[model samples]
Target chain A: MQRMADYISVDDGLVDCEVYSAAVYERELESVFGRSWLFLGHEGQLVRRGDYVTTWMGETPVIVLRSMDDVVRAYLNTCATRQVTLLPYDAGHAEVIVCPAHRLGHDTTGSPVSGQAVEPGHECLVPVARVETYGKLIFGCLSDDSPTLRESLGDATWYLDNYLLRENIGGLQLVPGVQRYTMPGNWKLLAENFAGDDYHVAITHASVLAVRAQGIEPRLNNSPGKGVGANLSVATGFQTGVPHGFLEVRIGEEFFEHDLMRAQSIGPEAAEWVRTRRDAVDQNLPDLAVKPYSFHVANLFPTLSIIGNGTSMEAVGLLVWHPRGPHQTSVTQLCLVDAGAPPALQRQMVWALTHQQSAAGVFAPDDHENFERLAENTRTFEARRVPFNYEMGLSGEGVDVRPPEWQDPRWPGLVLPRFTEMIQRDFYRYWRSLMDR
Target chain B: MVDMELTAAATAFLNEEAALLDDHLLDGWLGLLCNDVRYVMPSTAIMPAEAADARERRNALRWGSFGDDDRDMHFWLYDEDYSSLNMRVRRLDTGMAHAELPESMTNHVVSNVIAGQDPLDSELIRVRSKFMVHVVRHENNENTFVGSRWDKLRRTDDGLRLAWRYIELAHPVLPRTISIFF
Candidate 1:
């Protein structure tokens, strides 16, 4: 069988189609997902004792809950006796999870409640190796040796903190009800897209950009220019050795100015709130603040992806691309708003997110279509011989190292010009490193 | 006994709306909506019976606690007002909406129609119906969406028009992109 080295060449910027093969996919489940810190859900979801949300760590279903002790915990959502799934629901308040197969009950902390005769540790719900939280976001890792959540996040936190720990605005609170859907593609496809594929945005989302340019839906409009080249030039990509990647478009004070001008329409209080928040950001991270009101898409390696706009009106959507197989991916998207914002502003942010990024949203379909086609194309024998090119910025045309003037001491990553595949290349390099282990 | 005439009229209106959608005559479909139209599709969840009941109780207590009556904290596939709906139709008209560039051939089946006079408004009729939409795009790319809709139809000057529609898709996890309106 071809090894990880055969499937990807980071230096060559070429990825073999066989990377999507079943063998590679199965290996990644253990090598990459098993060892990586995967995002589970936000702490905001499990506010009260007994509150629980069911999600997948890779393909393994786990239940994240606030136990009776008020400590957040996660356990394999399966009965130890027959390995039957204990909880079938997406989320709920459950004091004890009972297996439908045999009526065996387990407490929220994965302790057996009904099984008395079974051997100790044999009949209890299996617990994940580690469950940790970065701010309000909860993450789980299957391997005990995996780095701490903060360590795994690395310099990526510099960007994440901009939203996850924004100033003046309260911490992020996940909106209820995750938007779950299945996509026809390998999980990596979606991950890489969010990692840094700003180039595709102008072309893939041309229609939406065109419509937004006309200013028909002013609240949802983020496009600054009509031409594809003009739109592509505004954003830049950032990558870290931690394998995290993100794209950002710097909108500068234009966003605050727009918010102030349209204050009467969005309501004066909400407008004033925006002004205060922007000022807080400027005070906190003066260098990074200029880029606050921009579109951002980032992937915290392996699965979790975030698409957020820094504007008060736009929401940050956290997406998990759970691998279903070599070809299928199950996506769970949760919308988040600043907890400090007024209820009305939060609602508008949610609405704006729903309008642009949800299942039926204007932008997601085109990306899904492309991913589906890529999945199909890469499955054939002929396609396996042809390597997918990732060499766009390799020759240094239209790509530049982070200029000294643009550097912020706080932001620590290999920041590159927008229209390059360097971020995707770094993503594969890290994936290859994991697969090599 | 069911009001057969009202049911027939409601069914006809739904069928007409379905026809316009299936035909990709989005503009014509938009014409069927009242100026204050509210089209919504809430994301569904699978929960234990007891857990669902508990959530309902919690929601009941928390309903008006937020000051604003915005109980729509849950994510939705769509929560469109008339203006947003108009913009959606206008998006498709742009011919660059690649998801539907090679527009999907759709068949919208509307059934289980039940209509009654609204308790609060004599000029409005509350209607409940089931819908199965089969969509085939790019030959092999196909998906079927089956759901139920609770709609409020008002007797407007332009005839009975959809004022509010709440869609509940049966699938907790949607199969694929929902490019077409239900």
Candidate 2:
């Protein structure tokens, strides 16, 4: 069973280790996701003890809670006897999390506070499989074998420091409110697409192209920001593997470039402001050789992906659901970075995103219909030989920029190949090694 | 606590305004409003009790006519002329070209029609009306939005214009950008 011969073939898809395959979506009671060091909420999100927010940790639904001591904690989402989630309310601070149906009561730390109809102690925020954080991003795991959140992120922390963390960067915060939508497709497809894909921009996001044409997209795009050099343009090519062209943090009149530096050198304050944060981030992303890009649209693995436009105004999260066995996927986009940015920046981000590719954007309707039909087409036959063309940058991009681990090279763009036959090749390489053992 | 004739007039006036929005008739809607029609859609924010008391339940987040000329750039609406209104209407047809699906299909229902009996201004009627608006939009899917509107109306020789209107939402954070007027 440890061999993982039964389910995954990263070459086919992420080779599902039998351990994980058995749990892909096993029932809530049995799934290991609930037990893994799942993502709860960010530390910045819960500043006070009573503050609490609910999040699903794989199959183990749970909540990251806060209490009187001002320390944050985790609690089981399930009621004592009933199967329903206990703290269903959106977000609020409170002394106790009580499930009305089961009458199970526990304090924020998930310990028995009181009020369980039982003869005695059944209260406690069932301990998480694990809990940890990198900068502001928090993770909770339910399984014993899965590594700590830091390890779970493995090497992604380096990319995060620039976007988050205050030490050397602009203060980062998530503007509240979620944007959501449902599409019909496999959840994994969306993740791969977000992880790294610049080929789709000209084709799929034609509407965004139109927006850029209309003078909305500030950074010059359709090509690599710096063409191929940070010396030529460090702050220039701060590219994110946007499904479309590139994600450049557009503040006003355009200042910083993709490499997280000023396009033109700056005053002591602005220069220090830009370089320190950029250096901190570069230190984290060990693979980039030098400054890796600052555009932080990340795949929190599994299903969630977010990208910070890195501009004060631009930040959004896409929570995509592509349930297996179903021919559809749900893509929810929440503009979570607007916790009171400057009025102008807010207007620009709101205008550019909402007006272009969002659910109602000119481009979304097209993409939605395309993805829907594509999913339906896949169902027509088994092993239909669905060919994804990741060949766009492949012609010249194959050279190893970083070698052994990656080929990003002096290349100006594309984070890494996340999916596709090529990415599948990378996946199988990793999965096969794991299974071979 | 107002008179009936003025109430009837205000109701008709509000209905006319809705027709304009429903029809995407930006010009007609603007023409019907006061030149100084204070159009501001301020999102509600949760604040500390002390802050709330200082403002007397009134805030910049609260949309109204500006009601004050010194602070009012009230003349901009008409000063722009029908060309501006045309631009707005065309922008809507552009389907949120200015804001992309920014405007939801809101059913602005103004009721509880009340008009003042005492005439303060020559032709102006102190009218108050209660309103409820429902907006539905299809983003990745379908979203239903609901809210209430408070309007203070003043009658003109031609018709009633919204001197001020305040929208209070049951949900403070709007789902997304609402480009269309309610």
Candidate 3:
């Protein structure tokens, strides 16, 4: 196995293909994902007592549940003795966790309540390191030494809360089952793509935009910004704030107005709600300076991504790039709606997400196919010899731009223009630090 | 009574549609749909055998607790009206759709075609067929989609046109994507 040092160079933007190597992947399973605060599931998934949902912490099976005592807890889903998976379903409610094999039963708190030939105080399921929440989002850490979720999120919280926490609404709640599918790609590729990889959209998603344009002729006139080029020119002056590497691209007033038209189609009440929220944001958070074609493909470190739509108000739900192997990733897509959003708005949000981001959706298909090809190409001997270019909009040494005055004091991180490659650079450096540690 | 002649005609129509899709004749396939056709493929979900009841599944979907959306304005794999289908067909036909940049080689094998008069509309015939769509791309990547389709065909003065179609994918987790239609 190669040392972690061979994986990347922060100076020249040289990232070794070892990042997708099985050896490096093994090390990451221990050093990276093992210690990081990983997104588990939202609190809405386990609202009622005895509610539980099954998920993964890297390759380890985990169960996140709302206990009979009304507290949220997570535990390794394997039975202690034979290591059999305790939870058979992805999600369900049960008074007691039971292992189908050998008939070992555990209480909601993961304590061994019933089992034959067992020692005293022996639990069938091992509890995870920590279970914490930021608003309704639940996250778990496998190692106790990992920083708290808020601390781990750091300055990115400001941008996260902007769409997560609404004034009139409480927080975003995940809508039903998460859309999941596997694709041939490294998990990190997904992380990099989502976290400020806007450059690929115009090319990778050209067909989708073209298709959408054909759907309605007026859409051509209703471009998100003056155009991509104009938006980048304006964003360059905005400057990068800190090295948090989080990005938020906001749309112009016309985008919201277009959404307002869609909301009006839903109903009058929904239209009023959209109008009120739009006006409130415009008046209250004037410093944000909502621009045309603004959207955020914000990544929270290792795996979780929060995608904010340019046209809509709330952030698109969580997108988890769960690594099954070096070349395999299982994607989990969740849709979140504002708690206070009317049913009509909720429906609209869900439909919008389904059409745009879901597995069968137009946009996601474009990305996944490309990622699959990337994984194939990168693994080849010829491609690994040369480093991929991340030099766009960066100085000779790859530092992002400074933050604008309006966002200076409030937002933190290596604030850069929306179109810069600095955000992805910061992500890789952060990843290297974690792996090295 | 099961009319053999009508059944033969319905089977021929279904085969013709499949051939159109395989030949990348999207416009030809689209032409078979009536003006107000509704093509829907509900998002598939993996639920425990106990939660397999239609009512229970619908309830979970309604509450946004389990599965994908119920056939409301909720999440769906494909919930297209006529105009939407037009857009989809138009997009696929365009050379720019990167997903189908070089269209995947497809062979749509259809069988078990059962046709009968529609109970709701006398002019409409209900047809059910099982299909297995084998799609190969780049000579290396390939997938087989096994599903059943329920289509409503209305007898027009010229010919029969598909008024409604509901495709049910058997697998809870699709192999990769349902990028191409079922």
Query: Which prediction has the highest DockQ against the true structure?
Result: 1
Better of 2 and 3 by TM-score: 3
Tens digits of per-residue lDDT for model 3 on A304-375? 876644445333657887898998888777777766678767766665666666777767777877876777
Overall lDDT per candidate, in order of appearance:
0.78, 0.46, 0.70
Report how far off residue A87 is in candidate 3 (Å). Answer: 2.0
What lDDT score is found at residue A307 in candidate 3?
A: 64
User: What would the per-residue lDDT of candidate 1 be over residues A1-437, giving only the tens digit for each residue?
Assistant: 55688789877889998888888999999999899999999988898999999999899999999999888888888766777888888998999887898787877777778845578768658888899988878999999986788888877676666645563467777787779998889988889888867888878988887788778888786433332321112212223346776676444556566656654476878887777767766666775622445446778887888876546677889999999999999999999887777777878888888989888999898888787777878888999889989988787633445556656656556656667888788788788878886
Candidate 3 chain A: minimum summed lDDT over ten consecutive residues — where? Answer: A233-242
Model 2: lDDT of residue A11: 31
Clashes of each: 0, 48, 22
Evaluated on CA atoms against the true complex, candidate 1 attains a DockQ of 0.75
Query: What are the RMSDs of all candidates, in order?
Result: 3.3, 8.6, 4.2
- lDDT string, candidate 3, B41-80, tens digits: 7756655566358778654332223333333544467767
Candidate 1 is graded, for docking, as medium
TM-score of each: 0.93, 0.63, 0.89
C-alpha lDDT of candidate 3 relative to the true structure: 0.70
lDDT of 1 at A53: 93
Interface RMSD of each: 1.0, 9.7, 2.3
